[model samples]
Target: MPDVQIRPVTADDRSAWLPLWKAYLTFYKTELPDAVTDSTWKRFLDSNEPTNAALAWQNGKAVGLVHFIYHRSNWSINVSCYLQDLLVTPEQRGTGMGRKLIEHVYATAKKAGADKVHWLTHETNTTAIQLYERIAERPGFIQFRKPL
Candidate 1:
């Protein structure tokens, strides 16, 4: 296979991005409202929004997707980056595409003056944890959330 090329998502990428987005959501066994997805996509295209998306392409097809956001953190002067979502097609999972997508986000965050980049994955996702452990540190933080 050819090397994967990573690029910031454009408005034209919606058709390519949606399938990956749904796959990611399915992996987590969760779903979001269509309106929310629409808003998120729009945010990625808006220059004023801190959220962004990128796609990993191979042979002229989008095979992976990542969404990251920059946010203020009280601990630092520079904004921190949250790697919110990462997804690669099932067939492409173990082919280094995930790591490449992460590195792409790291490069983007660095360019945007972000202090740190962080993300979370379910404990059950052992396969991903294996790869993530090699590329990034496990800060030993557990996440908790409550829906409003």
Candidate 2:
């Protein structure tokens, strides 16, 4: 484990958060327009939004990021937390940074009165699956999507 501090992102964190955000998208082989990125940043800073983000800092540098959203669930009365995005710098992977970021989300979600925290990752993300298995259960759900 590294001496890292994790906290909610603020208005001042855009510069530090953008690179990590881009790296995450690249890891997933996806890209979004600048407008979407700008809107996401704004959501993180907005108190009224259910979407939130955090950054992990070590030695005065941001090393990881996590984004989560709280939404109503049909099966539960309490909000369900979706751990949407999690990423650590390539050099920081396997140093417990990923787990720490997730644990941070777990704590945050729990504090926010969420019933459970869940997320999805590509089937080919074997490295992340290893870590995820250690921390969460696989519920045997397959996702299907259709573009409108």
Candidate 3:
């Protein structure tokens, strides 16, 4: 209910962004090495990289974080944006912070000439699905993955 500002993550945001990143990984019951986290942070700072990160700020504190990547797609000539990670602090969940973060990515992708923005969530994330369904359409594509 407070004034929220969404902005691209910067080198200075590393400290504020890490906790949200960790919390996000924790929510998914996953863990990554510190080096991987460091590499991801660096990628966001690299202009040449397709990866990017943004944060939702309320009164100078980051309440949420979103990570998106752009890549070539066979379905369209324009690049497609993949929203890889979205995390809102437990206290901030359902407060529209997540929506704001997602919309920010959508706008960013559009400005970059991307044709579509897509993402996946755990099937059990019903609360998040409720919001996502209202904003976007599901194409009923079941993901099949094999981790090497």
Candidate 4:
């Protein structure tokens, strides 16, 4: 695991962080303009959005990020942590940082009083799917959505 530590991201990380962010977007085939990224980077700094979190190097390089949010759950009084984004730099992947990062979030969620941590991954994301299988049990609830 090589002491992969997760900490709150900082403004200085922007340069190191952007490339991984782009790679993550490429992985999902989602596109966004620079302005949206511009605003989002600011939003996290504002601290109004607990929905945001990022992980970086203790020695000062960006290794990965996990964008999550805590929200009230229907079945439990405790909140839910929805892991919206997780990305580890390509060179760092498969070296166990991904697992460590998620484990990091699991511990964070628990400490934050979250009932559970949840997220969705494409079925074709076999690598991540394998990791998820090892790290946590699937809720077995397939997700579906549509625009109103």
Candidate 5:
């Protein structure tokens, strides 16, 4: 793994993050319209917005992105961080960049005084789930979704 430098999202990263974000959605077979992408960039880049954060950088021009948020949980006494998405260009996958991205999420959660950090994956996503098992225990919870 090359020395991957992780940093917070910046206003200038919008250009770099878009294609990577689209690729991430594609990787999961999720479709995100262009307008939603524009809104997302605006929200995260807005200094006053509290709902989003991201880590961005490149491995020799390949982008890596991790988007996360903190939320209140009724069962948890303290706030929790939810890792909404994590992506590394396929070229960066085996280079330990994914783990590093996850670790950055954990560290950010800790620094923010969150009691826990969690995320869900498709049951068939064994590769990511396997990596997750090492850094955090899997909490058995089946996710359900309905379009509004």
Candidate 6:
């Protein structure tokens, strides 16, 4: 609890957000083309897009980031929020920054009339899973995907 402030990313935040974004990708051992990263940043700033992102700031530095999206669900009339990405700087982990970021999304989604918020993480991500389990339930769903 180091006087953290969570807020939606502003245009001026690209500098602060990029390092955290890169760290997040590094954590997952993934890489994306510069074009994809550029597009993702634009989406966050676009009011028309359902994709949204926010950063956790501490002492004027961004220590965490969360990206969420709202989309229609076949099982519910109201939209469902997918908490797509969440990452806290290694030094900030276990300081509750991650939870605060998620709570921010929860409030935002609730205000938007979303039916639920859900996400998936690799099974090996036990640290994140621990935090997630405390705040959300696992419905035991398995994900299947095929890249075209």
lDDT by candidate, in order shown: 0.93, 0.96, 0.95, 0.82, 0.80, 0.96
Off by over 4 Å in 2: none
Q: Can you write out model 5's per-residue Cα lDDT over 38-69, one digit (the tens) per residue?
A: 88888887767655656546554645888887
Indicate the residue-level lDDT of 78 in model 3: 98
lDDT ranking, best first:
2, 6, 3, 1, 4, 5
**RMSD from true fold, candidate 4:** 1.8
Worst 10 residues of 5 by lDDT: 53-62
- Model 6: colliding residue pairs: none
TM-score per candidate: 0.97, 0.98, 0.98, 0.89, 0.90, 0.98
For each candidate in turn, give its C-alpha RMSD to the true structure in angstroms.
Answer: 0.9, 0.7, 0.6, 1.8, 1.7, 0.6
TM-score of 2: 0.98
Candidate 1 lDDT, 1-148, residue by residue in tens: 5788999999999999999999889999999999999999999999999999999999999999999999999999999999999988888978899999999999999999999999999899999999999999999987888979
Residue 89's C-alpha lDDT in candidate 6? Answer: 91
lDDT of 1: 0.93
Error of 3 at 64 (Å): 0.2
Candidate 3 residue lDDT tens string, 14-133: 999999999999999999999999999999999999999999999999999999999999989999999999999989998888888899999999999999999999999999999999
Tell me the deviation in Å of residue 63 in model 4: 1.9
Query: Candidate 1's error at 139, in angstroms?
Result: 1.2
lDDT of 5 at 134: 88
User: Could you give candidate 4's per-residue lDDT for residues 57-142 as a string of tens digits?
Assistant: 64567788887888887899889999988988878878888887888888888998998898999999999999999988898997
The residue-level lDDT of candidate 4 at 104 comes to 80
